[model samples]
Target: MKKFNITVNGNQYEVEVEEIKDSSTSAPRIQHQAPVAAPQPSAPTAPKVEAKKPVVTNGAGSVKAPMPGTINDIKVTEGQAVKAGEVLVILEAMKMENEIMSPADGIVKQIAVAKGASVSSGDVLVVVQ
Candidate 1:
């Protein structure tokens, strides 16, 4: 018979085993010692992640997502006239709500993203012209 002590996840356990010479022989006996205290786990921490900013391409009057997230709401529609800094879309990222505003005064030429659509950084949300 052999005995061994093991520690896993800050918990201690004792195990015992009996040797068997052949597969045709009887199975080995196993025993366990009294259980030790419950394991103590440290608090988990959130990972540090950098926010990504939207990239402006050659497309004129394009409004892009500043970060990866889901489109929460669209405040404007196609062909709607908008002024610079007016909220055109609402983006939800990292549990926070962000307003995507128009970059210039123009009519909305296109809406690339819809409500509940997932968009990555630099993805076009709307186009005004």
Candidate 2:
């Protein structure tokens, strides 16, 4: 028996798993054994998992950073059309390259971190409308 649909942090659990058979059988078997309480399945109305916030669209643009980074240069590509500051990538963090501009001129639509790719602070490098 095995059934598992679990999601933790947004709560959803229906789990049932049973596998126990080792058996050596020394003495006489069959006396009387009754102790079993493990079956809990009643919670599924569905409609909870909603934590989506990545849609940077006011003309959808983003080249975020400001801290925690290591994506040294990725100037633009993917359907490129950006221009509202327009540097678009180059983040090194402590050694400091940190340019990452362009927040609103549109049409790149998605880049989402990948040059050396190690971003953290705000982290969503390039999306541009």
Best by TM-score: 1
Q: How accurate is candidate 2 locally (lDDT)?
A: 0.67
Per-model C-alpha lDDT, please? 0.82, 0.67
Candidate 2 positional error at 10, Å: 13
Provide TM-scores for the models.
0.55, 0.29
Give per-residue CA lDDT, model 1, range 25-102, as digits (tens): 665565658966665669866889875333343468888888899999999989899987788999999999998877
User: Cα-based RMSD of the predictions, in order?
Assistant: 9.9, 13.3
Worst 10-residue lDDT window for candidate 1 reads: 50-59
Residue pairs in steric clash, candidate 1?
Answer: none
Instruction: List clashing residue pairs in candidate 2.
Output: 57-60, 59-129, 60-129
Q: How big is the positional error of residue 50 in model 1, measured in Å on the Cα after superposition?
A: 23
Q: Candidate 2 residues 10-95, lDDT tens each?
A: 45566665555666555533332233344456985766885433323233355567678699879888898876666777789888
